[model samples]
Target: MIIIAAVDDRNGMMFNHRRQSQDKVLREKILSLTAGKLLWMDHYSAKQFDGCTAPQLNIDDRFMWEAAPGEYCFVEDTSVAHFEKWAEQIILFKWNRKYPGDFCFDIDVQKPEWKLSHTEDFAGSSHEKITMEVYDHA
Candidate 1:
């Protein structure tokens, strides 16, 4: 399975049960990438993609055990550490700013087994810039 999320410069994801920030351009990027694909997320995260065109699956804790290989999962509040064994890759959207956050990404992309395969930067409507990083799990 693959995972995707947006994190702040300090790797902060959310605060007070809400996303720290958002960008329309970043949302478009996600929609373009996940278009015609199966995107999985928990109930809370699902709300963020209200008008998304892709097929979305609202999942529960059993998602980790039930998701098939090659599936794509978009996570925000979900802890991704548990998916290391099954994850094929990870796509991280790095917002070029910091925000107060109670929750942060739990996985360590710096680990030896994960390789930073690609990176690209783009300006955002709500952010100065955003970097998209793709890490392949070996």
Candidate 2:
């Protein structure tokens, strides 16, 4: 399966996007990956498409509901054992821990809080539109 994942500053691995391909070979890869899959990921990978009706999660590995909480383990491609090795690596590396405090080299480390916004909030240049509307009304 052509699964593209990234390890974050927290060492946490998030598998979110599946690349687009119509070739029979590519489709087979996807099917094999999700056939016995036990985890689902979000749409972080959608950014690659610049914006398209990309598949969020393959057939069986659908997304989790907003009101519900779910957790999944990430497996590396080179590993022999699937999810088991990935989960073990995460625990040993403390993937869930906070960002490291110090950096010996010239590296920038910033711990920022995540801001959740409605999809509509990104519909347009909202700030500019609001200002123009207010001026017109005035």
Candidate 3:
């Protein structure tokens, strides 16, 4: 499966069961990236995309397990360490700043098994710059 998430510089994903931040451009980017594919996410994560109907969204609490190979999963408030082996690619949208977080991203992209495949920085509605990094498994 393709894992997509938003994080801070420190890899923080959520705080007290809530996401760290949200950006219009980041959400649009995610929608664009997962277009024409099933995008799996939980109910809480779906709230951000209340009015959109372009992407094929699959809502399930067990989204990590439900997502098929080559499918995209928007992870917000979950620990994804256990699902690492099934991930074919990881796309991270970075906030470029730190936020208070209790739940953080588990996998270390610096590890030898993951290769940094692509990166780009763009302006967002809430942030001056949001960086995107795509990693592929070796």
Candidate 4:
């Protein structure tokens, strides 16, 4: 039930300390949907998220979630459904500590990495393919 959001960098997604775009409707909807669940976020969103009773998960100590060697991670299925239904215009990304980069987390619930599909739709759906780049956070 946590409506997790990350800061979008032109290069990739990050969560150490980045501000969220101002969108009253999106904020309200996020608050409503995440009623009382834990809302994990980076340090940048603390002040903006004021009045939000839900707990904000800050991952400052850990830059990202590292997937096991040869393993991957992503958002949940229901979360994707919520995204497609509510925030279709938005793209989602999960923390990948291992690779240290943003990836297109596919919306396949069957895949264990299926948490939230990194929803990065290009200008056109005909784009051949997209690849993720891993950075050295260490």
Candidate 5:
């Protein structure tokens, strides 16, 4: 499975069980990335994509365990570290700023087994700049 997440400058993803942030541009980017594919996300995360049309979505509480290989999982409150073993690729959309968060993105993409393959920055509707990093298993 391919893991997708949005993080603040400190790799923080959530605060008090809620997501740190959301942006219209980021949502569009995610939709574009998952086009023609199934994207699995828990019910909490599903609320963010309510009006989406394209890109099939599967809402399951056990999405992490249920997603098949090459499938996409948009993680919000969950700790993605444990699911690293099943991750073929990891995509992070960075907010480039700091936010108060309790749960953070825990995967050490710098580890020898995972390789940083691509990175790009774009302007977001709610944020000045958002960075994207794609890591693939080595």
Candidate 6:
């Protein structure tokens, strides 16, 4: 499975049980990237995409275990590092700023087994700029 997420400069994912920030451009980018593909996300994350046209599978806590290979998954409230063994690739959007956050992303993309395959910067509707990084399992 492929994992997609957004993180702050400090690799923070959320604070106060909610996302630290959001960008309309980033949401559109994710939708474009996952078009014609199955996107699996938890029920909470699903709410973020309300009225979206993409095919989404809303699962409970078992999303990680239930996701299949060749699928794309969007995660926010969970630590995705544990899925490394099952993940074929990981796409990360760096918010390029810090915000109040209690939840942190646990994956260390610096690991030798994960290769940084690509990176690009783009402006977001809410953020001035954001960096997108793609890592593939080596």
TM-score of each: 0.88, 0.20, 0.97, 0.33, 0.96, 0.93
* Residue-level lDDT tens digits of model 5 in 26-76: 989998898888899999999998888764789999999999998999999
Q: Which stretches of candidate 1 lie over 4 Å from their true place?
A: 56-65
- Residues 1-138, model 3: lDDT tens digits: 999999998999998888899998888899988889999999999999999886488889999989999999999887899999999999999999989988999999899999999999999999999999999999
User: Cα lDDT of all candidates, in order?
Assistant: 0.82, 0.24, 0.92, 0.32, 0.92, 0.86
Show model 6 residue runs off by greater than 4 Å: 56-60
Give the best candidate by TM-score: 3
List candidate 5 stretches off by more than 4 Å: none
Candidates sorted on TM-score, descending: 3, 5, 6, 1, 4, 2
Error of 2 at 88 (Å): 4.9
- Per-residue lDDT, model 3, residue 117, is 92
lDDT of 1 by residue, 20-109 (tens): 987888878887787666667777776766776555454564555666677778778878888788889899999878899999988899
Clashes (N, CA, C under 3 Å) per candidate: 0, 0, 0, 5, 0, 0
Span of 10 residues, lowest total lDDT, candidate 5? 49-58
Model 2 stretches with alpha carbons more than 4 Å out = 1-28, 46-138
Candidate 4 lDDT by residue in tens digits, 27-63: 4544554454444443444455666655523324221
Candidate 4: give the clashing pairs: 74-115, 75-115, 75-116, 76-115, 105-117
* Pick by lDDT: 4 or 5, better one: 5
Write candidate 6's Cα lDDT for 62-107 as tens digits: 6777778878888899888778899999999999998889998888
